[model samples]
Target: MHDHRRLGRELGLFGTDPLIGAGLPYWLPEGAAVRHALEEYIRDTERRAGYRHVYSPVLGKRELYEISGHWAHYSEDMFPPMDVGGEQVVLRPSLCPHHAVIYRSRSHSYRELPLRMAELGGMYRAELSGVLGGLGRVRAIHLNDAHIFCTLEQAADEARAALDMIRGAYAALGIRPARLRLSLPGPGGKYVADAQKWRRSTALLREVLDNSGVPYEAVEGEAAFYGPKIDVQVADAAGRESTLSTVQIDFHQPERFDLHYIGADGAKHRPVMVHRSVIGSVERAVAHLIEVHGGAFPAWLSPTQLVVLPVSEAQLPDAEAFSRRCARAGLRAEVSGERSLGARVRAARLVPYQAVIGPKEAAAGRVALRLRDGRRLDALPADEVVARVEALVSARRAELWEAEGGES
Candidate 1:
């Protein structure tokens, strides 16, 4: 198992302190840097997928939950209510209810059939003490949360578009889903006794998956109480699979909220709601990234992408100049621990990549790039190195690993 606590300390990422109370994470500078990068990627993807970004307040009236059925079903996970004037208010547990409120704010036409709204929402849920696990599970969690409002006829296309965005995101992280599982509620599961509704919704999802040629397993008894869902699973280092992302179709919420849009026939019709999380919970995704990369992030997402090691004081100027160039390219670069040439190189390897440039490389306007695993690529021009690093980060290409024996 990966020693997450040790790694977190070593990287100066996050920590739990008694003063902060239980189940709350204190993100240090390095942790915040990683989080910001992740949020930027998520924002970019959502924009590309046609989602309009909105900021919702952290607290909502208790009546909002009561109207959404969340107060009855999920009251335990919610923070206890506080008195706001004479009425009760509580922190938002999820973004869907808030998004639904936004949808109810406007009148819409068929032209605006597929309305996608998203938020990088910081939400709170009261968790039992036993459930807190570093960044994996916390009471304070940030989500790349979004809800898509679509007409019944446009549901399948919207779902596929969301899936495509998710795939693009995983591609950037060098992660791929080993399995696709489609969950449909059965008689004993979370589904309400609306047999015809469940059948129609499940069939539509299956048809979309079949048409896309995406192989998936039908998981009975795994659907959310609100609707059926599709989950993407990733294999960890130990070969255990965990859900990395999910797409849920919520048919019941729109009806419950009385959400409607004007149709081509000039009739008001209830819209379908789709909840998608390309990276699931940001906290869980960060923990998974640390494990999958073994704390050595790739060129793009590494907290400190490269450290410059100077041979001696005379070479410090060139090294500082080189680090600045990297910073100019939007890469995280630094220089520190000036010591013996060999010692500095060793310390540099402790990070993901160490760029050693002294009088020689600097005089030649080149840099010697070294990997953490003792591999070396030498004497590349600075511009070339920057381009190569950007490409690797953009592609999220995985490094080759040694085979245990030959492939079976």
Candidate 2:
């Protein structure tokens, strides 16, 4: 198995310390670089999709979850509540409750029915030590969560659009879903006991899935306490399956928090909440990416997208200047010339792009370009090379050479 725990260390991606506890893992510079790129990509994507980003406290008052039903339905997986000056607060296990409160803070009109709110937020879970391993299952989770407050007639379309976003994201990130799961409440499950609400929500999700024509399994007991959901399932190298993306239709929160909007008839009406995640947990997504690509990430997602190496000590100045130029052009670039040319090139073999400058090429203001797949182009002008790479990275193209035109 291409276990991320081993590969993370081998690639200088992440680390853990006993003092920081087992469930928490810290990102090394390389890992953090990849994570930052992912975050920016998701944020840009969300912005383009009309999502309004916000920041909410990771800690919430105890009564908050009680109203959202997390205290009753999910407290077992939550950290123990802390008392601050005789008031109880808990680290949130999910962002929906906080988002629900944010929606209720202001009045809304029918025109703003689909008020989409997004957050790249942190949530905590009390996972058992035995079940925790690597980034796949950690106590501290960085979630790419969002909620869409739409009317009843708009719920299905929003869910479908959310699925489209998920598919777009998976294609861009080079992720393949093992399965599509329609997660519904199981018998005797600890779910909100609202039969009509459950039926309506489940039917809406089913309609979306059916209309999309994507094959999926309807699994009982895989749903959230508040509603049913569409889960995008992915498997690691070891064939262990986990959900990396999800979409849910929640009616319970809008009612619990007395959420409403002014309707066209000038009457107060409840809004249906659609919950979606492009990348469920950032950690698990990275862990899967590491295993899926075996650490040779796509160019845009790679920590060090380009590495410039000098063929000899004499070319160091030229190589360093060229690398700085690449960096200035927004490529994650660096210079590596301390070792022999062959050794340094070999070290950066998995890197997406390598520019090897020899004495003649350096003097000519050109580089011997090497794509990670072992393709080499000789004596390309350094500036032209940078332009190709910059275009490729900015476009998030999946293949080299193809990015010069179309994706492969």
After superposition, the stretches of candidate 1 with alpha carbons farther than 4 Å from their true spots are: 1-5, 186-193, 234-242, 350-352, 372-375, 387-408
Whole-model lDDT per candidate: 0.79, 0.93
For residue 261, what is the lDDT in candidate 2?
A: 97
Q: Lowest lDDT 10-mer window, candidate 1?
A: 399-408
| TM-score for each predicted model, relative to the true structure | 0.88, 0.98
* lDDT (tens digit, per residue) of candidate 2 on 1-408: 488989988999999999999989999999999999999999999999999999999999999999999999989999999999999999999999999999999999999878999999999999999999999999999999999999999999999999999999999999999999999989887899999999999999999999999999999999999999999999987898999999999999999999999999999999999999999899999999898888899999999999998888899999889989999999999999897888888899779999989988987999999999999886788999999889889988888766344655
- Candidate 1 similarity to native, TM-score: 0.88
Q: What are the per-model numbers of colliding residue pairs? A: 0, 0
Model 1: lDDT to the true structure? 0.79
Error of 2 at 201 (Å): 0.2
Candidate 1's error at 349, in angstroms? Answer: 2.7
